[model samples]
Target: MRKFPFLLTVATIPAAIPAAATAQPVQSLDQVEETVLADDADDADDADATGEVEAITVTATGLFTRIENTGQAVTVIGRDEIEAVQGADITRVLARAPGVAFSRNGPPGAFTGVRVRGGEAEQLLVLIDGVRVADPASPSGGFDFGTLTTGTVGKIDLLRGSNSTIWGSDAIAGVLDISTRGRSGLAGSVEYGARDTLFASATGGLSEDAYFAGLAASFFRTDGFSSAAAGTEADGSEQFTLGGSVFVDLTDQLELFANTRYANSDIDIDGFPAPSYTLGDTSETQETEQLSGALGLAYYGQDLTLRASYALADTARDNFDPALGAAPLFTSDGNSQNLSLRGEYRLIGGLTLAFGGNREWSEYQTDSDTGEDATITGAYVQAGWVLGGLAAHVGARVDDHDRFGSATSFGGDVSYRVGGGWRLRASVGEGFKAPTLYQLYSPYGNLDLQPEQSTSADFGVEHGVRGSDFHAALTLFRRDSENLIGFDNATFTYANIARARAQGIEAELGVDLAPSLRLAGVYSLVDTENRETDNELARRPRHSATLFADWQTPLGLVIGGDLRLVGDSFDNAANTVRLEGYEVFDLRASYPFGDGVELFGRVENVFDEEYQTAAGYGSPGRGAFLGVRAQM
Candidate 1:
């Protein structure tokens, strides 16, 4: 990959990303439900240092519009919710949301990808601490969920549809914006579970009158899982991460902030030996290292919020084969650097404007010196209006890629409050993403690969207005995509030869039966098809549902359980391999004892239901974990 003075190209920056709504601490499942239904106020970082659960607000919007004001399908997972669903893997936690499906090659630490509304992983844009972390070295330039642990994350905002006007390229399917721990004082956890797995994490933060700083670290290791269906060897894995964030007030209305995170992982992989092109356990392993960080300044005025930032993401990978000596058989390195300036300002009565410009440089290189670099400059603007009981927002973006020329995207959404606890909303968004460097220049590269473009729209209705304890919503969504990029294994090359459509309905209901009890349920019916082949998209279930409930007993014992139900799916694009469906149930319990400490345990796959998400790869059956977590 070319090493150039990318930072010096700040002049290339255009109007780009703006701040989303900040998250407020949620204290219970009821509050979590309320957050999804409430969307009216701006807390500016939820300004409440009391650390109490406040009205759930969807604050990730540039103008801090409430959920009721936005037409897009969104789910916000906060720290309390994250802790409630205790798991090292981020994918498992995300599965609780509707229209979310994931596939893992074998056990944990394997190649994991998540598809939203039946959209491919590469179409999702992931941001960690405001830094885009997609691996440029990967053929799809996507972020892998396999190595990301939930410990360091404080919040997750999932927007389930295209909105490239705000996120720029790669926002075809959805956007996952994650923030690291911003909690005050000390907090962390330690746990031991199935497969002799050990996991631990620590986070510490100090908040002064004018400054706040935090540091976090986590380690995980697991053993005894075979990647190959017919193999007997255990493919172990281990990983660790270190991260920190800082915010300092430079003046009455000016603030400076910075964040950094690093992760390293090693996992045993399977391979097919010579003379046998079949999957089997082998002395093969993979190592990955990643780093992401950002630095920025913000000015907060009475009616204007402006921010400027510089961010960088780097990924390095190596694979080793014992039969080929001790040295790595393959290696790759890639990185992306970005500079941007964005802001939101009140234009007039009930009107606001959000605008930004961004310049990004990305490049990747393999061992064979098959390397390339590209730069993209983009600008975007969004206008929002609040008139009486109606709210609307529209946005447009234009981008110029050094290798793919220029493209334009537009999106619009509206929400209206009807009578009685009812709100109606609709949205339409468009996306345009250029081919990744690896897809265009690698050994199996296809020079003719075209950019992936898509359009997504959704209409929905919801109840849970006026702070009602019971909440329910139904959303209908559809997406049509063209020139989708995929690896052509038959010819051992990459191609833009696929077109697809995904249509689905998502329904969710929640009720706070009482202060001590809460129940939530989500269901999705995704109908997906390959327009070119007339087959259902691989690995996407036509039916998926999840049920969850929690109770706090008089004895101070908290118990909770969740069940996931999935329908059958095809393993290959041709739909020849059938993958059976399965259900998994989990039970969790916790009790407070010492100061700021809680003992927690969970029984996963209680019935030991054996399942396979992929054709030959088996999922973990029954497992259990016990741990302790503390917070001040």
Candidate 2:
């Protein structure tokens, strides 16, 4: 179910641009409300002409823009692919994309970090329903993918490379945009699998000519495997999440909306026990709760579009050790209050102006230290031109931090149709990641730390016919970073002393073998170096690839399978410990009955492979699961 990516060239715009990307007010209520998801039906003017639904994407440059209108390397995964995996982990879905790598500390619910284009995990900016969800309490301020289960999420969009000019800070690596179900429908799924695993999720929404509302919830629990490679005790994990969105049209040209999400998780963790001082089972546990929401209003005018939002993200965590008593060994709390304002104005002669401003105040407190806070104010503006046979955009941003002063960034991209069905794309961008509150004010923190900075460039070409199901793209990218933050063993503190470079090739293609069969493949070749020590960065495989195939039978049965290949990589910064590469295969199938219900099942790790992306961590073995899904 790959979306068959396309690289639109400037030559394709001899005609006018799509209204969905313009400032004109839209008439379709669903189109207006679904903007919460970063995409809308009015996406472009080509949808009606082609009679095929057009997939859209949002940009930091301006209002929600059409995918074909941008030059960034972007990947889109819809609900169909999520269900095809039939798994609860989101990292599994993300691994299928190019230029992406991840390392999990242990099993599900453990800490997981995703790295893009040689950039550290903490450099990526993640947005859920437009809320920046990174945990400021973390040492590096990175989101844990292991805690992100595939629940009511209906769409995922990944932008690879630096986009700081588009989103301010925290975009040195890239950006991951996730959206929950936004369409009008009733859907649910229940599954029971190995290790006493249970997963259940439900989503429902109602949409009218003037309003749209939706709710979704999911629960997951597993009597998991031992996290320690040498331990025999089983660690368990449990999680619950609930989210909802509401949109009401105040007028034909104005809309009001609210979005919120809540999650709670408890996980049993293994620790390095005394005496042996090695990873082993211990009486340790962690409990965490997260709440994020936003209230906003959007105005759609004949020549200008404006949006305003007030959002907050709050997280609290507690860790307990039996040896230290049941009162809890440690605790921490983090919160971010944000104000966002953005607009896009369409001018005459195929010119558009995109601008945005943001203000954020973040605070973090732990039992070990007093609470600390910081504020950041930023603004950016970009102009796009759709001339007869050329398309391009250039933007600049300025961000000022209460403690760290100011930093400025600039970026631009272009696309041109060279003729035939081929298009050429190229982009150069600058990005930066500010030091987290914990990094600056903690007991081991360093006030002298500066923001990590990066400069990235990518060039590629793609070939695909608009009406055809066949598509292919190849890109070459490189990124050089400075002032990267890392723990200094000698100083026993965090410092900005690392310099690095990451360069690689990404190739992807999708096609239909038959009317009922589809195949897709993505391959990445990444080369990374620490520069300081001349060693490859840990846990990033030099080569990786994924293959996907799906078949639809005449009897209405849908069968799908995917294979993953990873090359060897080091598990430690000094390259003293090696982690062998491994292969894992998975298969899933679903059959529709009547009454909007379907039965499905899946097998994971068909070969029961033994391998680890992180040393001393255990990987999942063969497992099976069965489930039923309902749609109404």
Candidate 3:
């Protein structure tokens, strides 16, 4: 495979461009979620220590918008929340969101799948910085969350429901946008946990008026438990991660920025023997490497803002089995490159016009399967309006694929303030997912397969207590999907042979009981069925909820706890195999010690409930971890 030249180009952009601008501090979790509804009457009295109204730019909308003005069901997870949870992986952190669910095959570092609103894993799009990270080699063209670590990630924006009008294919469910840390400072952490798990990370950077640069690195290793329920042999994994960003202000209104992240992991796995589906004594090892990065230039004018970016996501995997001799089992590589240009211009009063274009190239190679490549080009336009207490957004996109011809998607959302601290919103959108290269060119592929399409709608209401710290929201959503691709048992070939219907309700509440205490919770009820067979879709729970509380003491001590509940679901399409429901509890504590230092500890799965997200797979039991962090 040829090396990607764009990465090297991105690394050199900062050095080439000079910079000048006032340094902006990182946004806090609450500030990042600030609503568009301003409290003019209380602004003077409610000023922060800095005496400035807290606000942030939300990127989930393609065109940046204020959080409160965003008509979609969006959730923001900041660095503070990430640190408070003490999660070992990204999946654990994401599971706390309202309409998100995940199933892991085994221990950490194993193949993991995440679903949004009862949609399949592949239907959801994952983005880091601005680059799509789906793996073309995977059967579903989905990203494996097991490889994502929380150490370098600074913020996450989860947009639930169909967003293909703004984003493109594979956004039938939603989009997970992750932004890495880019603040100037020095920080590091070291941790040790059960099963001989060890983790360490360090980050440092400089964000001054002239230029900004940030870099972070992390290492993790663990002697994990068995992957299968019947296996005793330990399956361990190790990972190394490096990420960084650089920005240079060429002028007051123009800037150049580049960001990159690379991760490499080796995992020991268990496999089934000849006839049984249970774990056997066979030993296998898989190595995976992923590199993603983006380079962009932005211009902020008086009434117009423009950005152009080039990004790439590359992944490679190789497997080996000692029991099958020294030779390798199989190897695969996948790559996707994207170039995009977007701009926003102030139109008439209270209105903005947004437009963008994107071109993406995807390629896949495997030792056993056929190698193929494809390209896609798309363009989109949107209109955004904000007047008094009403906000509205409408967008449309047209995509041309090399193999599948063309597809068009459109969406619109409206929100209106009903009364004091109350708002009502409604949205309707359409999405589509094109067939992957493997589904079209491989041996089991069907060249005549059509793209999967979906139509979704949602209605929601939100209320925030005036002059208080309480907020609540309720949303009901429905999705109708057709031409779903699945494998046929009788013919042993891939084909588009299914349709699905999914509907769900999501509710969330947050309260600040006191200056030192906070509480939050979310609940979701989903109903998904296969339209062809009238059977419940596999691996989708009907009910799920999470509750969390945190408190800070005068002595610089912080304490928190989380309770997660996952309802029952089926493991197969026939609905004959049942997976029982389960609940898990976790506790965390942290105390500031010397200057710029803190000590923290957490206990996960306190009761050690035995549960399986996937049939025959083992979930982690009760475990404890301790760590310390320092910053300068």
Candidate 4:
């Protein structure tokens, strides 16, 4: 691979180049779902102190949009939800989402990824504060969800289905956009909990209008659970994160904001060789750190709003395997850098248009066998329109790589009111995932693999209860994929299979029940398989459901609990490892003494049932955690 520093000259296309025939066409929308926020008018007491959940904002569409009106299947996890769940990692927070699967190789904050709609881990795109965070050096080209801690997270938006037209490559499955809030004046937390877990966080805002600057930092350490095998117990890790942002009110109509976050984590690893199934003292260790920064300007007026941003990310990793009696010394280093600029505009009468482009440069340098350098450049454009009781959305993207020629993706969706407080929505889209550097340039072989692509269709209907705080919805979806990437069993070489597919239905119901109590239930059923191989997809449960309830009493206490259930599923494409179904429970309680302080505690894995959601792995058993929070 070659560096393209001067390639910018070729990248400049005279500004008048004709659009390619394959250039995607733009579309718009009419009706959108109204968002139901935590700060809704009905809950005056809950909205008084901590600001209602409705006050929370989301950047799900690469632009700021209220959660409910996003015109997509979007789920938001706000600060209250984050704190109540006692979730230490992204996997636990997103586990309730339909068609989403997560697994980890070690303890909390370890190597982990999310699989969507039976797609491989690499097919999902992960973002932090609107910046893409996928690791270019990953063997499978996916973002490692394990690196992010829940301490700094303000909210998370999980958008299901193909989003390639809005995002770009690696969005064949969907997107998980994470947003963290900047520290405000005099706000911080110091907490320690059960299971050897220690955590501390602080955020402070400076200047009036909170427009000058702010800082947030957190540190975490935990001892992990292990299998019965030796060398697998007590293998834990630690992490530290520091983030800062500056917001300048350039003018009344325009604001300039810049922010950056850096995270450093160290993990302890245990590897075992096959045949004996005995643990070896390999003493593997890994250190990872990532830096992300973005600067943007926004202008808003009565009828027009415009915004633009430039973002950059640089990440690196170092992995080491200590020398053993027979095992040779092994070490590897990998890094990647990316730069992107995007723009969005709002036109007359609820019409919005958006466009953006990004260039990414990545490299892997190591003494180990696999090493390479690669470059990828991608661009996209989108438009949305809305009218009374109707909404439409469409977009397209193109990715040109130095190795592969180019790939294009597009999608469109629409929603309409069906009367009687009922709504119907449908969408069709195409998404693509490019081959990673390891798959294309690794010394192990197979440099001729093609990119994977998929087409998806979805339909959903929702209804609201008249004069009551109750709602329900049912969604059906199907996806067809081509050039799916996999490895050959005989030679261990990367290859593209002919096809794969997933069909599923998800239903959700929520009720206020009463002023102090709320209840929600979700059920999901999926049939996912590989068409070419005639086998079940790996690590995808056919049936899953969740029950969650939150209640507050006159005793000044808030309590909540949730249950998650997953049915049996195969572990591999060959259908060899059959994982049994299991259910887990969690509980949380919190209360405030009105002195700007609160005490909170959570019990996870309440049943302590021992089961493996992943093949040949061990998950954390029943655990308890308690912490205190203070605000001023």
Best by TM-score: 2
Q: Which is superior by TM-score, 1 or 2?
A: 2
Q: Per-prediction TM-score, please?
A: 0.90, 0.93, 0.91, 0.86
Give the TM-score comparing model 2 with the true structure, all chains together.
Answer: 0.93
What are the per-residue Cα lDDT tens digits for candidate 4 across 423-478?
A: 78788888888788777766644777888999988888866421135667788989
Which clashing pairs does model 3 show?
36-68
Could you give candidate 2's per-residue lDDT for residues 91-180 as a string of tens digits? 778877898888887778887889887788889998877688888888788787766789867778788989899787899989887776
Cand. 2 Cα-lDDT: 0.79
lDDT of 1 by residue, 1-632 (tens): 00011110111122111122223332222232234334322232332321112232222243334566687888777777788888788876888778999998877888888889998887888888767899998878988888799878776778888988888899898888776765567888999999998989998877665666778898999994898877889888998999887766677667677889999989999888667878888889999999998888766665576779899999999999877899999999999999988877765556778888999999999898868999999998888887767878899999998886888989999988896667898999998778999888888887777789999999999875211357688999999999898888787898888999999899988877987898988899999999999999999999999898889999988999989999999989999999888899999999998688999999989999988887777678788999999877
For every candidate structure, what is the RMSD over all alpha carbons to the true structure, in angstroms? Answer: 6.7, 4.7, 5.9, 7.9
Once model 2 is optimally superposed onto the true structure by TM-score, how far is the C-alpha of residue 68 displaced, in angstroms? 1.6
lDDT of 3 by residue, 1-632 (tens): 00111112223221111100001211221121121122332443564321323222243457545445666777777777888888567876887788888998788888889999999999998888767999988877999888878888777878888888888989999888777765557888989999999988888786655467778888889999888877888888899989888877687667677889999989988887778755654589999999999888876565566778899999999999988888879999999999888876666567777788999999999998669999999998888887877888899999999998999999988878888667898888899999998888888888888889999999999875211367688999999999999998877788999999999899988777887998888899999999999999999999999998889988879999999999999999999999999999998999999898989999999999999988888889999999999988
Model 2 spans with C-alpha error above 4 angstroms: 1-53, 59-62, 465-468
Regions of model 3 farther than 4 Å from truth: 1-60, 275-277, 464-468
